[model samples]
Target: MDSYQENYQEEIEYLRKALAFIEEEVEKEAKNLEEKKSDLIAARKDMYENTIHASSDFESLVDINLHSMQINNYISSYNPQRFKNLKKMINSPYFGRFDFIEKGCSEKENIYIGLYNLMDRNTGRVYVYDWRAPISSIFYRYELGEVMYDTPAGISRGDVSLKRQYKIWNSKLKYFFDCSVRITDEILQEVLSQNTSAKMKNIIETIQKEQDIIIRDRDHELLIVQGTAGSGKTSIALHRIAFLLYEGLNSNLRSNEVVILSPNTVFSHYISSVLPELGEENVEQSVFDDLISEVFQGRFGEETRDMQLETLIHSRGKTSGEVRRQSIDFKGSRVFKQILDRLLWYYAHRLIPFEDVYYNGTILATRQQLKNRFLHNEIGIPMAKQLKIIETFLLKKVHPLQKKRLQRLEKIVEKSEGHEFEIKSFSRLLAIRQAVAFRERIRKFTIVDYRDLYMLLFKNHGLLLKLARGLTLPETNKEIILTTLQNLQKGQVHYEDYAPLLYLKLKIEGNDVVSGIKHVVIDEAQDYTPLQYEVFRILYNNATYTVLGDIRQTIEKTADGLLYDDISEILNKGKMIKLSLNKGYRSTCEINTFAQALLGEGTQQGYASIERHGEEPKVIPQETLEAMDRSIVEDIAKFTEQGYESIAVICKTQGEAEKVFGRLKKSVQLTLIKPRGGEVTKGPLVIPTYMAKGLEFDVVIGYDVSKENYVSDFDRQLLYITCTRALHRLVIYYKGDKSPLI
Candidate 1:
């Protein structure tokens, strides 16, 4: 037989053996688990029935303790996780394999890589190595040549004799490729050419060299990734979490200790399945707005970032929009951060009470003592905590004097002429009244609400001016302040104010750190302002961060979002490394080419397309809105018949999306994706551009690309985001003249 046929026969025999071994192991584990469960149940039953009266005697107590220990042992021994892993491996045990010969040894060993390690208990032989194993790094990082991998002992050098990748489904090898490169482009092209799905899948077998480097990096504490659209930033971040969990096996790192901050709820749902696919549980997922809402206990009405973007998009060129834009810019600026710092200083130095605290004409704590404690004793602490320290000190002083006074009154009452019982009752009532009065006095002086303090910045203009020294305020400063006060009065807060308000709250109320989170992943990092980064730094000071963003995809125009340099400066707690993923993999070359042109000149260098080609994006102009709608319906039908499952009709704003959905729902099956919360369903969908930030589809139809809708430079990113969501086809329909961006 030829070499190809010979290798195929060998692979088939190997698959049979692997399947048989997995089945046997699964049976063994199942038996062990059942025995352990029975032992635990019997032990518990015995302990409950016999130990009811064991506490009454020493010998009985000893028997009960023995039963308890037996139960604990049985419970700890009942592990069904291995059985589950074995069942998962029964169909497809491994995806890649390589034959390696050590530098000194003449013999070669075959290493099979899979989702989890598999071994033979009888012979102590490993059947497969987990993808995150140290030796598996060679499979991803090296070509067919001499390679070295780090082990617990040291570096081990070896030569790769053969490298092969397999695609096995239902215990059958569909195809296998013998590759001479790190990852064969044939496999990647095949994987990339498939249609889009509602949920993202794990890219384990086809991880590129650059992406594998990021996934396995353990040296840097802060990893910043600036990747273009379709560059697999989200995938890299998720795979990194799995690698960390595997590498930290002995260190007790858990899945729940890592948190991912996604763009929104739909995006969170979209990427939730990746970690579990890699044999790890999903980590904690949240958004910045959710964190803010949790901190405030949902007491205040807050505007969302998506809602703010929709307003800005819909109200372009209006006076109110300009005012709101200026307000957001000023609030998210460095000058505003400085102003907050000055305001904190003022609170520490000048906001203290100027009188001594006294009870019944006896001084408890002098004002100077309180000031000394607040300023000098509690150095480097939050002002709110410092005030708490002073309150505690004053209370300590009041307790002894109150006790002495009550003792003296009791003695006087005993010596007075009256019925003894009546006098005692009266004295007890008097003492209770005195105690209440004293506590009320202490409460009055020691309590300070941080909300009231924050409101002073807007209500007291003189204070704001004094704090804002040596800085240039925005031209609409007065209007901004007025708008803020009005929102506060109505129990509402603007989206841009969330960071500043939360930061100020942390400064005054002391940092409420979530100490358990060891790793934090911030997706779409370009959308966050500097102050928000600062807030994250303070809140998760102990966590290592992986921040991914692309500045070319920024759609928010109000806030001055932080770039890489600013982020490095703000979150610089340890060694930081920056990486870029320039290759676009989500869309075809034609789609990427058309989308890159929307970025204008200098920013187009951020991304390069792979060697995939498809139909070029088409911009179709119609005579009227009805005709445009009809054309869109026809195009959707054509794509659907062409086997495109996930199609999106992307609009500029939520209002526009609603109008389009209303007009098209009766004609076609449509699901409208709202800004706040919804599921991303397959098939044709109507969604706004901002809500479609981190999703992809097989076909995307831009609803209205008229100049009247997208009129400014700000809309370029929105249009680019809309077009880049397509994997195979992009169609733009406009009633009037096409947007200049197109």
Candidate 2:
């Protein structure tokens, strides 16, 4: 056998022995855990039955506290995650191995790399190192030659003598590769050839060098990853979160400290299992719509992003179309964000005119006194808190007025000619009580609505012009601003206005930065405007950001459709690092080639290199809608017969998706995916292109791919995104002339 094969056999033998040893340790630990679990349950039951009564004895309190501490320690010690880690490593001890010699060292050190580290108990030596270790960088980065890796101490210069990859399954070696340069397609091809499931797979074993750089980036405050479709950007992002958690063990960062903002609810659910599969807990996952809904908290009728896109798409030929588009663009820009900030600063200092509070036709507190208290008092605190101070001051002034009013009521009750003295006295006292309660109720100010606050800023043009001193804002039309304000007042904010409104709210009510999130991962970042980034800055100003998206997949156009460069400008310009992933592994070679054609030339840098090959996509031209529907249903049957379980019939809008589903649901069992459809099932799905932004299917049928439907640049991107969702088969049906972009 060759030297490579021999080494592979030796490694397999070592892993087998390791697995045998791990099995024994697992059994021992399991038995011990069971015993401790019984003791823990008994202790908990005893504590529950014997409640600690309130006592004055300090000694008894100390004894109870110590007893609780001891029980907690025993409970904490019973955690068998170490044994669980060994159990996980038994099937595959390691996926990579590297031989390296430090600059001054004469002997080479052999390092095996895995998801988690494993140690030799007898020798106190590390048998396997975690993939995120500094020394393990050589395995993914360097060839069998001179190499270097960064460490906490400094950069370590080394020479890589060997680089190897292994595929171990169930403690058996399936295959192995000894590479001289980089990891070859022989391994990646096999990995990509597998069938994709409903959930995203953990790609720790198959991360490429380009992806490794993105995953291990530590210095940049804003790390923007602009990758092509199916470039494993999302997977690399999840792995980066795992790496951060692994590296930050000594620091304050934890798994829950990281948050992931996905494009949609379905996309969030699709990638929910990725972190857990990588042996890390799942981070917080949410979409922009959900976050907005959460921030607004039902105060406004929030519109889903898909619904906004629908309005923008169908607004053609309408007179208000151009105005609406201009309004969306204006609201999403940094200039508008600046306007809101200036408005907040202006409002913070100037106290608005307050209404006088009166009781028994007498002024309890004049408006001038309240205004003086609001304007001349503390200026740095939040408006809500300032309002509270004003409320307290007014209440204090009312206390003296309340006393005087009660005395007068008592005098009138005693002197008045009433039938019964007790009844008259009680009636007068109740009137005094009601008047005092009314004064108290008036002093309690209602909260300012976000929508109203946003509109108030937009309506004041003179203040807006003053705020636009250092900034260049486009000439604003009075009509458009009024229309926008009218929409806001009606609780129907445009998609672009949502972020700015939230940002204004954050500014007025001090953004509580004590929310312990340390990192935020925004997927499908092309849809995020600078205003939204500003909102993130206020919400998580201290947190690191990982923004991942493909410009070609951006569905919203009127709102800030940011490319990588635009995003860099919006974030810290020089402090941000931009990375690109050009290799696409989600779809087959044939499918990617067809999709790339839609972008035409000048899109070479974003072109993805497909690893797997499949049948060329079939384009069918039908004369009528009925014919197209029949063809799609028949094709779905054929694909199902061919063992394709996951199939999607993609349309341009929800309306089209509903129409197709109404016809197809009778013939097949399928799910019509909506924006709030939290899960993407394994069977057939009828979905709009925008809703299917971050999901994939084994087979895809373009319900309609006509030029009339996909005429704009954003429409073409939607087409490209939906077409690339197919892994094995892709079929497009158009009623009329095909789109020129396609």
Candidate 3:
């Protein structure tokens, strides 16, 4: 018997013990669940029967109170989730272990880490520690040396004697390694080499030191991560959500309270499974367009972000495209935001009509008094709240005056010629009509729809010039105005217009803020504009934000993507920290190198790649479109035969993808990903570059990289994003001449 055999035997024995304990715990929890169910049913029956025979309201209230107390007790005490966790543990108990000795203690503790903690029934010995526990930080942060971790009490100092990692499945240990470093490349290399999946995987056992720091960071309210492509920014953000929920850093933090704003619906579904794999519920996943739609409430025909990008991609060099480009640029700029701010000031101060609140013939609140209250008295209050206060004040003043006028009207009706009952009925009807008219006048004076206010600014060019405040307008300002007015006349709102509209709605209404959201995670942050960030800051004002993006992957040609300084200034309400993840993890060394070369020098200074090797990206030039199509089909078949599970033929626009998919559907089975669709599917997929953002494939085929398609500097980011989606293979096919970017 050698050391290997001895260790195997020990592992098997421990597995048996852990399995037995988990089964026992599952049984105990099952019994508790059944007992609670019975109790709950009995309590409901007792309440119903007692309430039916109650003599008075007090007696019924007593019965209801007793039932409510019973229900609360049951809900608090009974947790069937314990059984689910135990069942999950029976398959794979733990993944890593560390031997640690406290500073003054001679005995060492073996800390086994898993998704959830398990304890011995009688002796109260810990069988496994939850990976999110404070002590488990050592496994990700330190090697075999002096280490310390923060706890609720203080810091715990210890010396790590040994660190070990395991790969266990179905209660069987497949492999184990003893390492002196924190997270060895041996494990990461194996994990990274696996085929890409439709859903993302949780990287608990392979979290790097830097990633660990981000996962556990609770000090900063605004965390901005500018990671390169394939650097696990999305993964880090998801895991950080799980960490925040587990730590309960914000007293009773829940998964739903953490909102993740993904780039698209497909990307949202791509990351939906990460939290559940870590034994946490999925957080709220949404896109910016969804938020915009919610705010606008289907009042206008809105264009999606993907639709906007698609239009720009397909409409190069054309007059309408240029006008649309300028429109998006100006609308998404800080100058536009300033103009909107000035417009808001005008609406609040100058545009709104100030009239006296009158009842019948007398004024209840004078115009001067109302203006003083709305403008002077409530200087710092929100416009919506100030309007509300003025309404309430006007109503209060009208009540007494209204009663006196009605009494005088009754006297006049009695003095006139009429039957006794007729006089009474006539007086009552007159009073009702007068009261309704009075309230209507007050409502008309106090309430203003902001949408109309927005429309006014666009309709009146003189007003726009006054609000521009001498800022340099875009050269295509007239075209921008014309296009916007045309869209507005057709009851349509362009995607670029959503941010400004949302900003105005939120600023004036101030009722759209969702106070329940505690943490906000904005993925693909580079695609967002400063105006959009401002809207986010107002909407989730109470939430701590985690923004993740890669500036190099920004493909929105209409506007400059978010810059570090711009975001820092917009979300400056709390402590803001910016971190960068430069190492490429989702791509091979060859693919990363090829993608980085597209950006030129100085861009690769902070970026590094792992030791994964693959064939260099192939650039194939074709004589015609037919040749390019055939080449793409052949490569797809070859990659499929090579055992790649997920393959994509990415194009520059939806129209191109449709044409390619139409041509190839007969030869091979394919999934056509549209700009507006549900979850993304695996296997050979034909998708536009905009739709493929924040997704990875086992093999990617760039269908068209010709000089005609990618001719401008604006197309650089689109080309870069299209190339970096490949994990194991990348092939670029061009018709006629290859792109100058090559």
The lDDT per prediction is 0.84, 0.77, 0.83
TM-score for model 3?
A: 0.92
User: For model 3, what is the alpha-carbon lDDT of residue 482?
Assistant: 73
Shift of residue 412 alpha carbon in model 2, Å:
20
What are the models' TM-scores?
0.93, 0.87, 0.92
lDDT of 1 by residue, 327-423 (tens): 8778877788889888877876787554577776888777787777667853577777766766666655666565456456556555653555555
lDDT of 2: 0.77
Backbone clashes in model 1, listed as residue pairs: none
For candidate 2, lDDT tens digit of each residue in 1-742? 9987788678867777767767777787789999999988887777656647565788767767776886898788897777677788888878888888999999988888987887767777787898888887777777888999989899999898888888989888888778887666777888777666878888867778899898888888889887888898888899999888888965568888899988888888899888876677747887778777877786667677788878877875565665666666677777787777777666655525367777567776777766666666555766666777676555556565545664565565555535345554676556755655664565445244456666776666665667668886545446567777677668676677778878877766778633888889989887777778777777886778899988777665542334566556655534787777888888999998999888778776546675678899998899999898888878888988888878999988889899889988887888898878658888788998888887888899987788787777767778898898988899998988986666
Total backbone collisions, model 1:
0
Q: lDDT by residue for model 3 over 574-670, one digit each (tens)? A: 6988898989998999999999998888889978999999999999889988888788788888888888989999998888889999999978898
Off by over 4 Å in 1: 53-76, 400-434, 558-562
The stretch of ten residues in a row with the least summed lDDT in candidate 3 is 553-562
lDDT for residue 724 in candidate 3, whole number 0-100: 85
